[model samples]
Target chain A: MTRFMDVHHGMEGITADQLAQAHQADLAIEHEENVHFEAAWADPESGTVYCLSEAPSAEAVQRIHERAGHKPDEVHPVPLQV
Target chain B: MTRFMDVHHGMEGITADQLAQAHQADLAIEHEENVHFEAAWADPESGTVYCLSEAPSAEAVQRIHERAGHKPDEVHPVPLQV
Candidate 1:
């Protein structure tokens, strides 16, 4: 599996509850894509959210997020980690 | 405490060993700034490195990276998390 970091923009003013819900949305169906969204963090003031996950590929992560109703602006593959 | 995602560029072709060393450098001195670098991931092809940390502030993260000899190109504050 490869680690991925995805970013989403234009969610300004997102609250903690909202962020958790969005993350849970992805988690609920992530298994179908063989992806695990480990965690999500956001700068509510800037509406920028970052998600770290382990997936077969970036596309899998993207598809999961899209189906969860919060598509990412970019999905970066992070194959090398420490 | 806040979660910060910092990015570093221009280290193309970085190897796993090199990445670990770089991350260790930050970990070695993170406590001085009350920062804990949780993990680091990189894409050698893109030379993009992302550092995840819990810090008192974004500035503290930047300072730690700078002191550790891999100053970041960007440090984003992620105050809301899930």
Candidate 2:
């Protein structure tokens, strides 16, 4: 599986609780798409959200997010892991 | 210019102060390469570091990281912001 990181913006003032909820939403449907939502981070001040996952493809990552109702602004493959 | 998010791993015991120092190192050379290191987040327990930046290309981002002496595991373009 390829690893990917997706970003979301304009989420300023978002609370950790809300992010956890969104993460759960992604987790609920991840299996169907062969994607695994691993972890997420949010910067309330910047309104940015980042989600990390291992999936078959970047498209799968996007699809999972779309299904979760929080489509990503961008998706990029993670080539290196240190 | 495009925005990008880069991830660094295997930093489980990294401290916030270390991250700040790394960030400063990047900032010190950002202008020469047309890369702007915006913000960074570190999860001490997970050993993960995320950096946000605006750069001319993904390579430029990588170059900045390399100069800072903390190469990223991956770099991905950020295409959407909402």
Candidate 3:
């Protein structure tokens, strides 16, 4: 499996509760794409959401986020450790 | 291979030239650990550094950063795509 890093913007002014709700809502969905959500972080001041996920491709990561009700600002593949 | 996301602080008041120098220095090193640097971003205003890498563990990623000349604030692994 490949690894992906997704950076998201447009999260400013969001409460912790709201962020939690979004995560909860996204977690409920079953994604067909080969991706696993590993970790998620939200910077309150920057309104940026950073997530690490394992997926076949960066596009798969975007698909999962779209299914989760938010759009990613940047999604890039993490090349295998050489 | 696993994927990692690293967040770094303590970059405030640093010049862009300094940041570029650090990156160049780090990129010159060869790490024994199985890790590949995917991307890096720096915010001049906020003094935050974000990086994406593929490795077997977060420590491997940190070691690479250390070899590269910076300490990370946070490091986490991305699980395999299930």
Q: What would the per-residue lDDT of candidate 3 be over residues A1-82, giving only the tens digit for each residue?
A: 7666677777776566776776665566525775777766665555667766778777777877888888798875543222
lDDT of 2 by residue, A8-52 (tens): 889888886788889989989999989998877676766778887
Q: What is the descending lDDT order?
A: 1, 2, 3
CA lDDT of A75 in candidate 2? Answer: 79
- Per-residue lDDT tens digits of candidate 2, residues B1-79? 9878788889877765677788889999999999998877665655767787899999999998998899999886654
Rank order by DockQ, top first?
Answer: 1, 3, 2
Which runs in model 3 stand beyond 4 Å of their true positions? A80-82, B1-82
Clashing pairs in 3: B26-B68
lDDT of 1 by residue, A1-30 (tens): 988989898999999999999998998999
List TM-score (chain A only) for every prediction. Answer: 0.96, 0.97, 0.81
Best by DockQ: 1
What fraction of the native interface does candidate 1 get right in terms of contacts?
0.91
Q: What is the lDDT of residue A53 in candidate 2?
A: 85
Best by TM-score: 1
Candidate 2 wrong stretches, greater than 4 Å: B1-82
lDDT (CA) per prediction? 0.91, 0.81, 0.67
Model 2 root mean square deviation, Cα atoms: 10.8
Query: How accurately is candidate 3 docked according to DockQ?
Result: 0.07
